[model samples]
Target: MDAQPDPVGEPAGSLDPRAELSEFLRTRRARLKPEDVGLPDFGRHRRVPGLRREELSQLAGVSVAYYTRLEQGNGRNVSAEVLDSIARALRLTDAEHAHLTHLAKPKLKKKQSGACAQQQQPVRPALRGLLDTMDSVPAYVSGWRTEILAWNRMAAAVFGDWGELPPQERNWARLVFLRPDYRDLFIDWEQKAIDIVCMLRMNAGRCSDDPRLASLVGELSVKSEDFRRLWATHDVKEKSFGVKRLHHPLVGDLSLQYESFRLTDGTEQALVTYHAEAGSQSEESLRLLASWGTDASRAGSSVRRTA
Candidate 1:
């Protein structure tokens, strides 16, 4: 029997879990200080920024040699207890802890026999209908890799008509980094960038075998220096809820709260919706924006009919 070739046109290779685990541990360790970990801060010329390998090993109650091997990216023989102790020593958050676990013990991928190209994420028609019904809210459906699978008119009005963008350019990461208009749209662009990069980092941990994700990461790394810096930090964040402060060209300032709910259809799909506080100026602005979007949509429809 001969080995089969990988799927055709897979432009990027899968992320190396060993390398990811190594960098993740190193970055996490680099951010901590001896004093912060309740260890004695010896006033000496130190080459490294944070606690030494030996100090960390001692804190985790493991042999220096074992901890060193794990930090060197050999997590093949790591135990659950050891991982937990090391996570505590590193002061990892819930999200970071999960990311660390995923990196250290990634699930075995099933052998691929045929086409392995990334499939287009399917958005349920009902979900799309739901988005359309949210006339006063800006809502959209995000699938794996944060792809904008479907969106309502209000979302188009607030976030720019994603329908106008080619499918590949509809991602949040690309829009945030590659689009200049988005930089102006987001009042706190740096924070938005950080959040996006962190989300990608978390996704990378969970979906190491996703070739499209690998390609996306590679593209951003090559094209955006800011992305490169943030990616190197190995930070991870789970998207749940947040407040977005946007400077809409037509509506001025908008402070909108967004909530994301995971779809229960056994898919990695989430419905994200944004709304303004009740009786607030932002709420008034949102209503005005919705009206403007409706009018524009009507005018476009009329023009198409005339043509």
Candidate 2:
């Protein structure tokens, strides 16, 4: 009843999702402040930004080897009590904690046997209205898989072409690695790609058993070596609100601030919007983008999504 290698054993790409989950939980623990978790420091020379795996093991009252195995996704049949202890030690937020538990033991075996694990279907109409209301910032809604479900005119202008792609190919991960335009569009494409890999790692833990999620990974594995390597490393991170550099053909380059608002009623679908400070260069760039979008809007160039 536990996660195991299939007959002939699935390739690392197939079982790599578990490795991803483990790495994320382990990495998150490694990056925590001892003070945040009520742990006393020994005044040792700190060489790393986060807590050591040994320290995490001690805090969680588990053997270092055992914890290491968990992090590598080698050990299964973990107890809920231990998972709780690790969660507490990590000082994870409620959502993070729930996600951690889900990673430790997928819901498919029991919890998802009959219960409704899915959130509200698709993006809410009210949310779409809100996206339309935004004056200039590009706004869009995307599910956990980075399936871009909806977007406004400004968003349509920026990543507008993506909406024209098939749903399976429209995934942010795919676009970051597979699309030729990604390199030209992102000023810091490498960092952005790394960030997407990390974020996708976090999602992999929460949705490892989801068929759609599996399909996305399978498709990416077959098509993108970048995605394949990063997914194999099993890294995960949380990057919600931040500044990003973008290169637009019409507006040149600009630094934009963005915020990700998660909808509780949806399936962790997020609304991300980017804006420039009132007097920032990005503001001018955004105006140019808006102007371009207005022109596209007038042309009635509605991009139809693929898949």
Which candidate number would show the highest lDDT if scored against the true structure?
Answer: 1
TM-score quality measure for candidate 2: 0.71
Off by over 4 Å in 1: 1-9, 108-118, 294-307
**Per-residue lDDT tens digits of candidate 2, residues 146-254?**
6667778887666545444555565677778877666667888888887787676566666565555566677777888877877665555666888888766555677
Candidate lDDT scores, in order, read 0.79, 0.67
Which ten contiguous residues of candidate 1 have the minimum total lDDT? 108-117
Instruction: Report how far residue 63 has shifted in candidate 1, in Å.
Output: 1.2
**lDDT (Cα, tens digit) per residue for candidate 1, span 1-307:** 0111112245578888889998999889999999999999869878988888999999999999999899888988888889999999999999998888878876432221111234644677777778878999988887557678788888877777666556677788988898777888899999999989998888788777778878889988999999999999999988889899998766779999999897766556678899999999999988887888755444433433343
Model 2, residue 154: C-alpha shift (Å):
0.6
Q: What would the C-alpha RMSD of candidate 2 be, to one decimal place? A: 8.0
Q: Estimate each model's TM-score.
A: 0.89, 0.71
